[model samples]
Target: MTFWALIILTALVTAVFLGFSLLRGRDTREPAAAYDLRVYREQLAGVDKDLARGVIGEADAERVRTEISRRILAADAQMQAQTAQAGPPVWVTITGIALVGAFLVGGAAWMYNLMGAAGLPDQPLSLRLEQAEILRAERPNQAEAEAAATPAPLPELDESYASLLNQLRETVAARPDDLQGHILLAQHEANAGNFPAAYKAQQRVIELSGDQVPADAYSHLAEMMILSARGYVSPEAEEALRQALQRDPRHGPALYYLGQMMVQVGRPDIGYRIWTDALRNAPAGAPWADAILAQLDELAFRAGVFNAPEIPAPAISGPSQDDIDAAAALPPEERQEMIRGMVNQLSDRLATEGGAPEDWARLIAALGVLGEGQRAIDIKNEAMEVFAGNAEALEIIDAAAYQAGIAQ
Candidate 1:
């Protein structure tokens, strides 16, 4: 009620001001003939003054007087003509001003009705920001809940696999101190979709390895727990992931799983950042790279960060002669690490962000040069999917793969 009253008051004020301006303007317009007559009388007075001062001869004074008289006659004739044609009726002038006032008020109201939320309360900036934060907090959990509601189809394993699993379990139990036996049991159980068993086996492996256990062991243990829980990041799993990260901050599986936990906990932005960095540092054929790429777009959307362009892979001109010469200045081991880092960067960029044909070709060639023929082949296949409709890109990538001896 108060809001509507304020709008009404404002409109009434505007209309009143406009009406007063229109009426004042109407009263201010004098007849053109009256104005001309006043101007002619002033000229006649000026001519008389000149004559009295003797500044002009009598002839010149007479000429000026004649012109002024003619102008006065013209003004009198015009005024008489104007009087003959009746002026606008007072009613008509009042009606026109009223119409203009109505238009000013009605048009404003009409436009507001069309474009504004007339009955809605104003949304101040602070309230709007708070609402947006709430939405962000809820969106990730909503996505996770939807995913969890749909149960995955059961795996079809052969009886031979079950027999193999039993044999592995027995072997690991018989040789409890054999770390390799525990590792094999964990891997086979995980592969066979027996995640609980895999988790126990991985735990045993961690125990046997003691402090010498690598970060990846904890990461794998965490993963089996998540898989057993159907993707739930239980507190124990979170602890294991945290421990893995503590041992190796860049452990790919740990980073990827931690990102999933972050997303499930309603922190998609943090999840995206962690996954993206992990993808950037991941090796060419790493599973973490694939996992991150698969979810990158969806995570970005959930975080309200859509429209991030797929950065084209860096153009693939290899090292120049100067670059080769510069590398020679470094020690051999450092040079090898530098080359490996550059290759990993290129591979990660293409895998996560995609790139042009030249970039894919360059990456394939570089992998081959580093004696990673299998990775080059896998990248070529993936690039083929990315460039499915572009014959030119397919040809370039194919030719590069052939040159690298991985085309088949």
Candidate 2:
């Protein structure tokens, strides 16, 4: 990462290349191990001389020479096979090498220029962290410590966020045709947990997109829908997500948030299905993938589906079944049944309490896990009815449910 460090790394790598070159230069040649025909001729001459002096018969001498030559040819063929050159490079490999070199040099120079712009001397991680801790201690209370423990709650950003929202609104009010202004205002509202205002902005954007070339408008609205869904899943948010996917089904944010919204509206089965679908849609190593995986893990654990039916037990090298008469008498199937019963009690105990939102979401998720999709839809409709009075919340749930393909 540092210049000196990179220099050392490069030198070490170059040395490695040199070492490999040396190894390759070694006489993999098999030492011309096959005796030369000329040498064989010399041996034959010596043999003839020995025959003349009564050391060996002609038959034995010829047999010895022939055997040596045969072995030599076989060994030579094997040695040649070992030293043969591999085929030409693949296009992909060549392209990868080119990309790597370009990025390495370009990234280093770009990084150096950018860091120079920073201008400030960097502090060590420990010193920086210590300073942070001291500054935190200097504050009136343990707000910093609590924030570190959880996701720091949305900052007390009301004034600043409100100004940004108002500015965006005024821009929209003046132009009315400013789709971007509406999108920005909606995003700001969602950030401030004002789902109603955000939904309204997004709805207007959708209408605008219908009348003109949206150019990523659906995706823009979907992001706000997702943000709003996190705090409240209502019809408006759901519809927003539907519009997003109708435009681009693989819109990553919409896929993930819609998956979550499905869980909130008493359609866990549909939620689980949607979430699993999202896992395929999202890029690897992203937060959406992680969230889906975590949800899947918890769901599987809860449903008593974590164990594999065909898992092989580790083998005991020195096994003797003679000692455990009672245990050995039990059938494997019956033993597994007992284990399931024991695990059920433990799982129930672990099912303590999550907040109401989590509970509703989990219920929806469970339906998905159980593969009872129709049941999940029925649940959504029921919840939708109950949520009707809360227009903003109902709007999100309805939108989520609709996008999830659950019946209203």
Candidate 3:
């Protein structure tokens, strides 16, 4: 009400100012004829003074006086004619003011009606955040999301491929304990656009693996669930994502989905941070990298990051060519010492500042190669803890552990 009142007052004041100007008219400048008459009178006075001082001859003064008198009479006549002319009618002036007032106030009201949110109260940041929390809490569940989804039609399948897929599905259903079969069924079902079947097979795969299940398996389940729901990240899907992250914190797919879920729940600030980290650590050609890149700018804008940093190139973390060359130049005895020194440096760095999974894997492999089996095992144990939920990183470290004879 206060806002509307201020607008109305402003419009009225503007209209009144304009209307007063119209009534007063714009005839403030001196009339040309009146100016000419004043100049002529001044010239007559100057001529009389010049004659009184004997600066001009009688004949010259008399002639100047006559010319000045003639100009005065002509100017006076012109002034009288100008004064006789009338201005616009009083009614016209009043009507014009009324039209101006109507245009100002009516146009303002019309424009506001078209574009403004009528009667909507101000939404401060705190209120907005509270509303977002409520929205997040009330969002649809997995079943609801799936029910509401309109999945695209599956593409036509070739007869032989369809027959093989059917056989695989039947084999998996019969041999419930076959982890390999479940894995294959999950992959094939997902490819066939049967996300429900795909997620069921993936669940079976995870169940069969028991404590040995990798993050990818859970991430895959989440992906299938989201797909089945036409991209809605339901509670079930989020749980799958949580499981994946619990196994592998650096899991790209899980991180991407988690960021998406944050955005869905009105937390673009959290989403932007998650995506930035995911993109920073992501490998070349990672599937999630492209998706993150696509929406990151808009996400940053929503998160109030006006000047978001550029996406950095993937860091190349490994021994440099110079280090390799330096090691090669040393004799066998000295090379052993050099290798030990390098290993010690890496170990110290990992302990103090930490490093990527690749660095941990490399250290484990180096220890194994040095015939330090106990130390290699110890390092593998530490790497497992550091990489806890990250399946891909654990895989790399586990491979090194296997090569080192620290694991079967």
Candidate 4:
């Protein structure tokens, strides 16, 4: 045990040994009291002899005898008093008792030492936990201890990068200024082969575009961040797409998505309408007009919208082309007003004499490429005429449109 305890034990053991050795030599004999009577009688005989010799007068002799008797009694009384007076002080009595206890404890410990010692070695934590689990599995009757044995089940972790990216995209869209959302979206997108989108997202994060600050945020600048989120696509991400469509009904990407969902769920009307709307809003003479026209033509062919001949795409830089860029180069507020004016004028033309869906699609794609997302979206319906029930065309259109936003 402890040092002091060992010392105390040793001292006690020694004391006990010494006590046994000393006490054994002194006492295995009878007490001397049995032979003491003879000596007493002989002394009495001497006193009588002295009396008969008349060493003193009768009165003196009597007085002497009385004095001797008194002395004997006094001696006995003195012995008793000395015995009483020999009592130990409180400290001495307490110390003696303690010493006796120590000796007993020490002696026992020493005896135990002669017997032998037993012990075990430390084990790994995993092994220990495994053992505990085995014990619990073996006997589950102990209530309080059962909790330790039966820990809560571990929750499954999600690791889907595509799904995570979509979630981050939707979150940032809704919140507009959340750095974490931006970072997460950017990282996941990069992992999914959308490096450009990833860079855009990081830009927003680094800029700290919003007021909120999320703790434990790491910079999204490497392959590791993107890879970490990689896994199977998630339902949440799909739902996010749905939510996006709700906010902007003819959101071109969503328009493109309608056909895919319709096939799976057995409904294409909603999707057709969505694409139609996108085409309605698209530009008349922009370069993307032909592709938009083909998609709508094919979709209409499938859905029986019409058997109209495929409209051709006009040249990129045309004779009728206005100085759209010069006007757009103005301050955003001014450019927006100009776009609005252009939309009004276009709306008047369309109301008077309908434009081709290809025209609408081209117009929309051009505006999107120009970074006037709002202006293009404003005519999504007319743009949608290019791909009424077309999933393929819409898909390409959707990517371009969304990319425009992402890159910006």
Give the Å error, residue 320, model 3: 28
Against the hidden true structure, what lDDT does model 4 obtain? 0.48
**Tens-place lDDT digits, model 3, residues 116-135:** 87777888989978987897
Worst 10 residues of 3 by lDDT: 320-329
Compared with the true structure, all predictions reach lDDT values of 0.74, 0.51, 0.80, 0.48
Model 1 clash count equals 0
Candidate 3's error at 268, in angstroms? 3.1
> Model 4, stretches more than 4 Å misplaced?
1-238, 284-292, 307-408
Pick the winner on lDDT between candidates 1 and 4: 1
Writing each residue's lDDT as its tens digit, candidate 2 over 1-408 gives 465456446655655565455445442433343446446556757767887898888898788768767765666676566654343335544565555555665665577676653334567867755664564334322223223333324545546445545655676788776665665556556656665466678778667666563424565555554443343434554566777677677765566667665555434555666666666555432445655665666554533444212212221111011111111222444323322332233324324421122223333333433345685576566555655586765665555354345634
lDDT score for residue 168 of model 4: 50
Give the TM-score comparing model 1 with the true structure, all chains together: 0.45
Model 1 stretches astray by more than 4 angstroms: 1-153, 174-177, 304-408
Stretches of candidate 2 off by over 4 Å are 1-154, 158-165, 211-230, 265-267, 302-408
Q: Using TM-score as the measure, what is the rank order of every candidate, best first? A: 3, 1, 2, 4
Residue lDDT tens for model 1, 1-408: 666667767877887787677667667767788889999999899988988998998999999899889989989998887744345666776787778767866777787788877788888867865664675454433225435544445577667556655766786788888776777677767767778778999999899887897787899899988887788776678889999999999898899888998787667878888888887677544646676777889999987786433322333333322222333333455435544655787777766776667778877776665667898898898889999999988998999898677978
Better of 3 and 4 by TM-score: 3
In candidate 4, position 330 carries an lDDT of 38
Task: At residue 2, give the lDDT of candidate 3.
Answer: 68
Write out the backbone clash pairs for model 1.
none
